[model samples]
Target: MAHPLDYLYFSAVMYTSLGIGDIVPTGHMRFIAGVEALNGLLLIAWSASFLFAMMNRLWDWEPCVEPKDEE
Candidate 1:
C-alpha cells in the first residue's frame, strides 16, 4: 500500500472478515488475509468457551424445595 492508513484499514477488514470489497488483496496478501480471518474466528470461539465455563461455575443450579404443610 502506498499509505500506512491503507494497510491499517485493509488489515482491520481482513481480521474481522468484513469483506467490505473496497480494498482487495493480491497474491501472498490474500493468504495473509485468510490467516488473519481464521485467527479472529478462533479467538472469538475460545473467548466464548471461556465465558461459558465461567458462567457455569458461578451459577447456582440447585432446585428449590417447598416446605411440607402440616395439618
Candidate 2:
C-alpha cells in the first residue's frame, strides 16, 4: 500500500492464482484479482496446447526399419 513494490507483488500473486492469505484485496480490487486468476489459468492451458501442437507438427515419431536381403 505504501510502496509501488507492494502493487507489483500483489499482481504477481493474483496472476499466479496463489491467493495467499496475507494482503487480501478489497472492493474493486477483488474483482480484478478474480479476473486475473482466471486469465492466468486460461493462458496457461492455451499455451500448453499450443506448444504440444507445434511439437507434434515438428517431430516424426515413426520407426525406421532396414529391408531384408533377397535370397
Per-model RMSD to reference? 4.4, 4.3
Candidate 1 RMSD to the real structure: 4.4
Local error of candidate 2 at residue 22 (angstroms): 1.6
State every prediction's TM-score relative to the real structure.
0.67, 0.75
List residue ranges in candidate 2 displaced over 4 A: 62-71
lDDT by residue (1-71, candidate 1, tens digit) is: 26999888888887777769788888898888899988878887889999999998999766579766698
Candidate 1, residue 40: how far the Cα is off, in Å: 0.7
Best by TM-score: 2
Candidate lDDT values, in order? 0.83, 0.85
Q: After superposition, how far is residue 8 of candidate 2 from its true place, in Å?
A: 1.6
lDDT of 1: 0.83
